[model samples]
Target: MTDTPTSRATLDQVGASVTGFFQDLGCELLEYSPDRAVVALTLAPRHLNNAGNLHGGVTATLMDVAMGLCGTWTEQPEQRRVAITLSMNVNFSAPAAADSRVRAVARCRSGGHKTFMASCDLLDESDRLIAFGEGVFQRGALRSELP
Candidate 1:
């Protein structure tokens, strides 16, 4: 299904309910499906670095969140998947200006018993690619059996 503003809002609420981290970071989940997820963030002055552009850490955080959500789409209540970043490589293609809306689209590339690979692109409102990233996540055992 195509993502709508209402659906994105709902996902943001759900993300907030699941973890305060998103709300605190001013991040929102804009789209979600089995294969991908898109996260949005309104660039704020606080998100900028001394260089006067969006910080690399903020972009990395958005990428990681989007990738994790993509992996979580396949999770079942009876089973669970926990992911830890094994490696992440990011390339800043352009500076994300302040007060602009940024979207991070993450796609799952591959997976196995305990590892998943994903790639994400950070785009501005005009769909200009600002940064790109790829990461590997190490999945933990099912939650039911975990202490």
Candidate 2:
């Protein structure tokens, strides 16, 4: 990442890019800001697990995306962040049915020169908490290069 006036522009560009990327995945942004972000996705049959409930991987992915994006919203253009999922502890509280509108809310807890930490929760349409996660990510290089 290169910090410059142009970097600020790139940051804005990333916001749009992130939105587009999720939209393509059938997720919609309901709220977004530097400290928090919320996204929703309608559970489909394709997202089901072997037992018929929403898959654990799907829930984890949604939480991760939301948390990472929350960090992105606060980052300077020249300073990119990569979500490493260094540690994610997820608690599944309920089973989510197909066609349910699932919402993921992510909040950044702390961030600094080289790392960021965040938490996220996944809720069903009725606002029932289905799962929650806390994650740590290393920031600076692009995600592809982060280890």
Candidate 3:
């Protein structure tokens, strides 16, 4: 990530280099700030189900990841935080075809020092809604604080 002029710009600098489960799912971080996050996934064969559409589990995972990231983002890298999903509800509206790209946009709706609520929308390439989710998350130990 390059040295950006603003926190939001800095967040946007991180592109498809997300690690762990995000990397495994081929997720690209498009934009992230205090209360919002946008992540795109490159759909593949493994992402589909028996009916040849995006699996509900995959959609739920994407939603959880987006909401968790949205709720836990911080300006200070060293202060990087984590959010554990307390509860989540996913509403599947449309089907996403294999090999098609989908983007999940998430927003933190409300929060305290220890917990937060967030919502996410999964959209196809044409911006059709694939799924919508809402979740409550609890703040967890920071990455730096992890043993």
Per-residue lDDT for 42-106 in model 3, tens only?
88988899999998888988888889888877666555687889999999999998889999999
User: lDDT tens digits, residues 51-133, model 1?
Assistant: 88999889988998888776666333334445678899999999987898999999989997778899999999999999998
Q: In lDDT terms, which candidate is top? A: 3
Q: Which candidate, 1 or 2, has the higher TM-score?
A: 1
> Residue 113, candidate 3: how far off, in angstroms?
0.6
Clashing residue pairs in candidate 1 are none
- Overall lDDT per candidate, in order of appearance: 0.78, 0.73, 0.81
User: Each prediction's TM-score against the native?
Assistant: 0.81, 0.74, 0.85
What is residue 119's positional error in candidate 2, in angstroms? 0.8
What tens digits encode model 2's per-residue C-alpha lDDT throughout 1-147?
A: 223223434434444455433545577666656767787889888888989898888888788878887776534433445455577778899999888999999998998866789999999988899999898876545542211
Query: What is the full ranking by TM-score, best candidate first?
Result: 3, 1, 2
Better of 2 and 3 by lDDT: 3
TM for candidate 2 is 0.74
